[model samples]
Target: MTGVVRLATRGSELALWQTKWVVSLLPVPTEIVTVETEGDRDQERSLTEIGGQGVFVKEIQRHVLDRRATIAVHSAKDLPSTSVDGLVVGAWLPRANPFDAIVGCTLSELAPRARVGTSSLRRSAQLRALRPDVDIVSLRGNIRTRLTKGKGLDAIFVAAAALERLEIQPPVVEILDARVMMPQVGQGVVAVECRADDREMIQLLSALSDRETELSVLAERSFLRTFGTGCSLPIGAFAEMQDGTIMLSAMVAAPDGTRVLRGSLRGEDPEQLGGLLASDLVERGALALLSASEGKG
Candidate 1:
């Protein structure tokens, strides 16, 4: 609190935008430390092949743990469900539009055998389930790069929040409803992490946290944590407050979109609601779907 707070973050355009927004809200001086992560190094490979869970965050987290940075900023969805041993999320920014958006063509407008581009297995699986006739192309890169690559494709799926944050508006954009496509856990949220022992830093960051967003992310992440650390299958969970209770909806699917399991639950405790929903889905054959997908991998 005495000196400038060094905020560690990825060098991506979206990442920087989110971090700067955080800086704007802080009452003290700040410095942005951009770190290129594993996921940034390999745009040619799929996330699962390049190590899915922590590829984008480990190095950025290392900066904080090693004292090179005071805090780490992350697009919450990029983080693994399990927390790092020495790190803790000090704050959760208010949620944005937590829904997938399609650019170039509407889902209903695409012709048979049309190609849909996406880098997320969750998006691919759901798209495949919805339109078996269309092709799910493997697309990768930053938002600008992806938009350039999607020129030849019939459509490309991206996060609605990403488009909003970057202020990029495609000629044709369609927001997919959560009921049609559940979002990834922690989607549309920005998380700030610091060392668990940094009591002063934690207290400073906590002042910027939004209670509703924290509870929603807590429930969604609890559901994801129930799936374990090595889960690479197509999984999606979304949580929101309804009256005084937390309502969570989740889905687990095969990579190929053959079998999908969906469940939901409401409770006053976020973690309990998430865990219960996950358990219900697992009991209804979510594990078998995970196994089949892993075996295929």
Candidate 2:
């Protein structure tokens, strides 16, 4: 008798949308169980203070561990760097745009010192690098909230995938090139997690895993782990496979974006290639800016 797979996720519109998309591709029946996460509870606080990368994922993971849910679905970018002992990532779905978009009220817009709202330091820093005159401010909430409250800021920055999922046409979206604005590790990918011993569920999800996204995210995660930067750090990485070789680009910056260190490395081995790229950046003084970015000495 095949049991139903209970997938745990936050109840946010985007989160549920992602889960439904994954479930659509699977053969087995799925039951969605919404778990309110720390991030959802404290929408006013910065993610770093509320619990960092795992704030949204921990609750879903807990549901799986407690046997209340057979699997957990999460935005791959929000996952913790270290793998949990009791669970395994059963799949990494094919990625989306994986780029930041600058959205404004009009395509032809110009307001010096215009306020720009964003929750991520990575996006803020990259925007500063490109347009230092804009005033960057912290804005956190679901897509609907942010867009509704977009009154104060002249514009905002958000993931392209999120906007597309919502089916809302951003008034104007300036998509930054990946070479200029590297994405966070695992961005635009969805991860399905299950208890390591759930062989049946694992086999089902394994079929949905995208090998290219898996390898690329693996490399990006390795790079981030080696650097030891948290979500608050002004760091970004993006990796891709090019003609059977892995190429990784990464950056570390002072929070203010006044100083930044960027570099890349390539190799046949994605993990090793990422480490080499991170090490090269470290050797060339990336640690200095990374430390400052993290508010460390």
Candidate 3:
């Protein structure tokens, strides 16, 4: 806790902002070690074709495991549901806005057959559910590039938390309600991963962890783990605390947006609540929808 903590992160403006925010919260000196993962280099290919979001995370995690860095900071939602071997999410900062943001126009404001851009399957599926008449195009890049790309399209889907953290102002900023577009698991949370054997780093990072955020994400991740997937699957899970109780909500949708299953459960035990809700979805034929999407990919 007294010495400098070496933090590894992706080399993006949003990533740097998140890491710097973490650094500001720490007591000791912190140095950032920028690491570019596969996702950064292969900007044109689809995430599913290139091994999912894990492509953006693996290299960063390696730095911590190899001792090049003492810790790795990441957007919680980008992380895989299952914990990596020898690494643990030592801390989760307080949550941010979990709803997705639309730039250039609101969902309802868009004209029928209007072109919308997004790189995420979840976002596309939800948007299609709302506007089957619109055209969805593949859009991939950083915030600046996406904004630039949006100039060609009628609208774009982005994380509200990312825009809020960067204090960006778009021509049209509309925050989508989570009820209409379920958020990905661990959205709006920042998590730091440390080697399991490094008790010192664990203790140091643990001090910054917020219990409420940790529990909320725990339940969300539990749902994801039960479903056995990462971002590759068109599924979304979100959890929040309400009056000392946990409410877990999740959705499973076809990539084409033909079918969508939504469910929620309230309880004290985070893991149980997550599993129970997941089961509700499975019993309601979510498995079939997930299977069809997997086959298409």
Residue range 57-104, candidate 3, lDDT tens digits: 999999999999989999998898888899999999999999899999
Candidate 2, superposed: residue stretches over 4 Å from native: 105-110, 295-297
Range of the 10 consecutive residues with the lowest summed lDDT in candidate 1: 288-297
Residue 204 lDDT in candidate 2: 83
Better of 2 and 3 by TM-score: 3
Candidate 1 whole-model C-alpha lDDT, 0 to 1 = 0.89
TM-score of each: 0.98, 0.95, 0.97
Whole-model alpha-carbon lDDT for candidate 2: 0.83
Residue 151, model 1, lDDT: 96
- Lowest summed-lDDT stretch of 10 residues in model 3? 288-297
Model 1 regions lying over 4 Å from their true place = 229-231, 295-297
Candidate 3 pairs with clashing backbones? none
Which ten-residue region of model 2 has the weakest summed lDDT?
Answer: 288-297
Clashes of each: 0, 0, 0
List clashing residue pairs in candidate 2: none
